[model samples]
Target: MIRPDGFDAVVVGSGPNGLVAAVTMAEAGRRVLLVEAADRFGGGLRTEELTLPGFRHDVCATVLALAVASPAFRALRLDQPVAGHGPPPVEWAHAPIAAAHPLDKQPAVLVHRDLERTAGELGQDSAAWRATVGAAARAGDPLVDTLLAPLSLPRAPLGAARFGALAALPATVLGRTLFRTERGRAVLAGMAAHSMLDLRSPITSGYGLMLAALAHHVGWPVAVGGSQSVADALVARLVANGGEVVGGWAVRDLQELPPARLVLLDLTPRQVLAVAGDRLPPRYRRRLSRFRYGPGVFKLDWALSGPVPWSDPSVSRAGTVHLGGTLDEIALSEAEVAAGRHPARPYVLLTQPTVADPTRAPASRHVLWAYCHVPNGSGRDMTEAIEAQIERFAPGFRDLVLARHALGPADLEARNANLVGGDIGGGEASLSQFARRPRYSPHPWATPVPGLYICSASTPPGGGAHGMGGWQAARLALRRDRQA
Candidate 1:
């Protein structure tokens, strides 16, 4: 349905954020053209038979976190109205085990969505877990709005007060005060590790607790086939709304693009400046020039002969499995990664889709998804190390692996130029970078050039599966386009 004569708006990437922005713009009646550098349209939402011909694997971002919360996604009815019938548990798979971290030569900790049950499971430290996560979850709407919204805008006074009250506590202290059992503490630390921050660091626990609460409030559900289905759903919306997507044409420079009233760069700041060159303001250029990228990752996809034999049987039922021994052990591993060396036993996150959706593989054979945090750009193939971590918990892990494929930091960057050295969250998620992300500019989305805006994980809310950055950037672009 493309007009073939340029467009009112053009998006330069096909990542989730880019697609969301394009869909939003097209929905507003603008002629939007979306361009992708890869052969296929979806970015992180891509799926392929990496390990085996029949098994499918998510290239990146397995869990659907902020996608469900996105106003754009909800309004579009992205994944609502469950289609064909399947196993009742598979329909939603609402239960996620928070206390499912396997220990070295010991019993694993298990946390379910039930707060009282989770507390009783923790025994002594249950009160702290209940209070911290409970208080936050009870009032998550405002907190989430503040957390996910662009920091460039003035903070809502009431929301700011609530966030400030919550933010005032240190994550370490909060964890210590909440749960006494090592299992309970480790479970919470594993959640905090999602922040990509030092485990022992303060405030890093907020995202984990908030997200865990969200999982309990609204289960961490994935599409029936894989994450690619989610992207396809969004792309369908874009096309239905009369938008165009150009696949297989990589955008190396911005000037080569056709004329348009506004251009939204759904890329990291580095890629933006590289493509736009002198079109950017000197001050804007300077700010972007100083933007930082965080630690890299080593991702692996596996075709298993059978499901993961987790020490705790319940771990198999949950969508996400945090696999770094105890809370203290995970903290040490994360600290090691933060210290610029791969952990002796890296923190591993695993998701087995075939368990939930049988379509992912053949019969009982399954597709196992896992990734571990490594020093940014580290080329070390820690496949053995990761396998060892899994084997420690799942004793026969190696025997079950039918085939495997891996991507190092360099490989990740080559796949998506925005992942500069495998910094998936766009740039690192630090305090200074979170609010003044990409730069100290009051308007994070607005560039010095009137019609240009940076819309990616590099902006506020740092990184996640969420498209709030795109939504905020689109709002800014739509407003500016109207004024013009």
Candidate 2:
């Protein structure tokens, strides 16, 4: 059944990485075939009706802040109308407030799209906030281009140098030492906590600082309908460039694939070890096996009768909310998970898309999804703890739930094998892993297996929806093909 001579290249696993790889090859005049194991195309970008009918929910990632800020996506110009393709299908929706971190005894700390406005509310921490997060925002695309390609020579060395000055520090240390205000420290803690690492872990501050910068520079946004629109748009771009997508076709082995000059696997090390089994050299296989995974997550999605009744009304206008109180509280919660125990009060990263795009639910109703870090592969249900954290900030939150869906680590893995025990960032973003991700090389995407490349988040500049990993991999493949 295989047309062995039809395609010049094949990309397995239809994630952001794989999709981007296919698009890049096809655009460069290669006959490309993109394959997915799932019935759908998007990996983390998928959307589904998880609850009652008509109440749509993002199955995975919702926020497109990185996508907006990404140099890879910027080159695609998805916002602009292509010459023959007409206007792009994707349009971003923005909430009044980008993010909020609510506290028990005070008004929530809000991050507005306007930098000065966000800093103005921080009182004594205003200038310090501007000096760090503001400076990152001002550095903008040049710095983002450099940061997204971690192993490459810095395009903006001055900006990169400035960033490294603060990035190497732990979030806990940076928060306590750099900023004096509790509001400033607490907000940074909330952003850094997204890394799913111990708050005291090195380079945790980088995650927090970058997120805060994105909020100011791009303003956190989601797609108009659901995040799936993003996947649709990317697919449209691919099809326009003559790439064919074959969905629901799982690639079990290299032998199953049609003959192609190049094969790009958008998979983590675990899947790579399985699919490319015995084909890889013993030493390379061992390195793939040795790749460590990070913390898992417990996810909850709710169809609400009405908007969350946040005690602080301002929080209701925010697209995203961090629900673990102060800097100390968040640090402890993340540390508990890092130490292999679930915190009684887990740090909940909640997003209310209806705040920005109400089309997700029935009229006057709303849809909400949240997840909290857990020990890797842990099966424990965190429904009660997650809801309690939500209730802590938004009173009467439980009453608003028309229906709810909960998925533990195992459930996430069942739905998407790439999740691999629900370590969604693809693998640990630890200091050592950051330096030598899945085995370091000048070209991390290229596997020892000639004509094959690995282009998942497991490589350098790990995780997030930015497609730099795939873009970089495809570019390298093109270069290699030219040389060959």
Candidate 3:
């Protein structure tokens, strides 16, 4: 075949991180090409007719909180409005105000978006809730600014100092001190449960707090149509800036790539090794092999005839909902998954996108997105378990389900190889992995190969649709190319 023009940078995968890397490079006046293995762009960010033709569903992440918190977005001049998704209103809703403890006479813990209202409702734990989330909100912008930016700040000293102090807090101290009431603790613990780590684990509390802070600062809102809108918008920006995206290209080896000064991969470490092979340094290869991957998940999508008849009306108003009953209950569920045992009671992360965006389904129909923590690569369909959980809080949940589909961890991996063994968050967000993800090299964006870099969720900040990994990788590649 005839040769195509050599581009300045090549990005594999068209997920949020991939698109972000492409856009950042293109914005910097570099020739960029983004390649996706799938027929369409936007890997996990796609919206499809999984249930039925007219009804649409989100494939993976539906929340827009991380995108909002990302510093990369601020530089893009991208406009992503959250209010349009009925944020803080139709988007948010409560499961149950009380924890359904087996035999406890005490009521279930409640989670409310409004800090003051939430505090007032908490019988004894009001002070703790106001202290942590309340304090974090007060110090939110500076904290987010520091975390989102690249490690090398090329910064106002005052801002840097503020961010430094905030980042220094230990996980347990932060969580335990913030929300005192069992209900408040449960709410925060539930947020932390997003990680596959044990609740009482040293670093996990921080991960939960970090996400919770963002939720409080920028309400966890879904995209107007679905998360695909975000992918489309980024791709649009890249194409607008002269970047090209080729679909259906499964990159198997580095040598197969067209000549380019820099190659950015939006894939996991395994893919990197598979492609790069012996080209990578021995130490780097060994470290990549030793990298830890987290537990998997099972997802369920429901086409509800109407909104989830939540007993706690507040949950119905949230853009995203945490569906584990109590702090201890959630912790137990996570613990079960960690031990490789599938728990009958699993903690679920759920959302009702149609409540916020009418485009997701017909006028009267609604789309319920949900996922529960499960053992790695588990092939168990969790539709019934997930529905049972929902029904626990919304008694009549099963009656409203018009259609439903479920995907086990293995199926998730089949769809996205990056999610190896269905371990999303691009592997685990353990302490070491959080900052030095994939490998412990100073420049996470720079791979052992001179012209290659990893720009996926497997990189720094480890997971979510923040796009930091891509932005960082692309920036390094463009800068390195300029120097060359």
* Candidate 1 Cα lDDT to native: 0.76
Residue 310 in candidate 2 has what lDDT? 91
Model 3, 100-190: lDDT tens digits are 2211224434444455765676767777656555566556666676666537652344544643454345444455565555666676766
| Candidate 1: residue 154 lDDT (0-100) | 28
Query: Which runs in model 3 stand beyond 4 Å of their true positions?
Result: 1-3, 80-114, 153-178
> Which is the winner by TM-score between candidate 1 and candidate 3?
1
Candidate 1 residue 242 C-alpha distance from true site, Å: 0.9
lDDT ranking, high to low: 2, 1, 3
What is candidate 1's lDDT per residue for 1-484, written digit by digit as tens?
Answer: 5465878889988888888889889989999999888987668888888988889898997667577655546666774533332111113333345336677666666656666676676777767766666655655555566667746442355655654554545456656765677777777877877777676666677766777666555556666677777777777777778888888778788777888888888899889889989988787789888988888889999999987888867677766788886667777887888889888888888877766677889998988878898888898998999998888888898889899999988999999998988888899786667768877766788788888888888887668767777778888899888987
Of the two candidates 1 and 2, the one with more favorable lDDT, higher being better, is 2
**TM-score of model 3 vs. true structure:** 0.89
Clash number for candidate 3: 20
Considering every candidate listed, which one attains the maximal TM-score? 2
Clashing residue pairs found in predicted model 1: 99-109, 99-110, 99-111, 125-179, 125-180, 128-178, 186-327, 296-376
RMSD of each: 3.3, 1.4, 4.7
Residues 377-464, candidate 2, lDDT per residue (tens digit)? 9989999999999998888899888899988899988888889888999899988998777897899899998889998988878888
Per-candidate clash tally: 8, 0, 20
